[model samples]
Target: MPDVTKAIASDIFSGRYPAGSSLPTENELGVEYGVSRTVIREALKVLAAKGLVLSRPRVGTVVCNEDDWNIIDPQVLAWHAPHALDDKLFDAILET
Candidate 1:
C-alpha cells in the first residue's frame, strides 16, 4: 500500500501527471495496483492532505500546481525523489 502511494506520489511530482491533469479513477488505480478501491481512495487522500492533489466530484482527482506543493516537507520531497541517489530523476526532483 505504501509502495503504491509512493509510486503515485512520485509520478505526480515528476510531472507525469501535470498540474490540472486528472488522475486515474480509483477503479483504474485499483486495477493497476491490484488493490481495492478503498485502498486507492485512502492513498489519494494522503496526497490530498499533503496538498499534492485535489479531489473533486465528477472531475476526479487532479495534481496540484508546483507552487501549491508542500516541497519543504522532507517526507513529501523524499517520496518524490527516491531515484535521487542515482540522479535518475534529479532534474525532475529539482523541478518540484
Candidate 2:
C-alpha cells in the first residue's frame, strides 16, 4: 500500500501527470496497476493529504497546482531539490 502511494507520488513529481490535470479514474488506475480500486483510492488519499492532489465529487481526483503542493514535505522536497538546484546552475551559466 505504501509502495503504491510512493510510486504514484514519484510519478506525480516527475511530471508524468502534471499539476492541474485530472488523474485517471480509480478503475483505470486499478486496471493499469493490477491493484484493486480500494488500493487506488488509498493512494489518492495519500496524495490529497500531501496537498499534491484534490478529490472532488463527480470530478474525481486532480493534481493540485505546484504552488499548492506541500513543498517542504520531506518526500516532496527530496523529489524537487535536485531539479531546483539544476535550474539555478543553468540560470547562472546563462548569465555568463
Candidate 3:
C-alpha cells in the first residue's frame, strides 16, 4: 500500500497527470495495480491530505497546482524536484 501510494505520488508530482487532469478511477487503478479499490482510495486520501491532489464528486482525483502543493514540505519538494525537468517548475521549487 505504501509503495502504491508513493508511486502514485511520484506520478502526480512528475506531471504524468497534470493539474486539472482526471486520474484513473479507483477501480481502474486497482485493476492496473492488482490492488483493491479500498487500498487505492486510502492512498488517494493520503495524497489529498498532503495537498497533492483534489478529489471531488463526479470529477475524480486531479493533481493540484503548485500553489496548492505543500511546497514547504521537504518530502513533497524532493518528490517533485527530481521528476520535474521544466525550468519553470524547477525555479518554483527552488524558490519555495
Candidate 1 residue spans exceeding 4 A from truth: 83-96
Q: What lDDT does each candidate get?
A: 0.81, 0.78, 0.81
Residue 43 in candidate 2 has what lDDT? 86
RMSD of each: 4.5, 5.5, 2.4
Residue range with the least summed lDDT across 10 consecutive positions in model 2: 87-96
Q: How would you encode candidate 3's per-residue C-alpha lDDT over 29-95 as one tens digit per residue?
A: 9998899999999999988878888999988898888668776566666666677556765667578
**Could you tell which candidate, 1 or 2, scores higher by TM-score?**
1
Model 1, residue pairs in steric clash: none
**How much does candidate 1 score in TM-score?**
0.80
Tens-digit per-residue lDDT, 1-96, candidate 1: 778888899888666898999999999999989999988989998888888999999899999986686765676868866534435345445766
Instruction: Give the TM-scores of the predictions, in the order they appear.
Output: 0.80, 0.77, 0.79
Ranking by TM-score: 1, 3, 2
The whole-model C-alpha lDDT of candidate 2 against the native structure comes to 0.78
lDDT: the better of candidates 2 and 3: 3
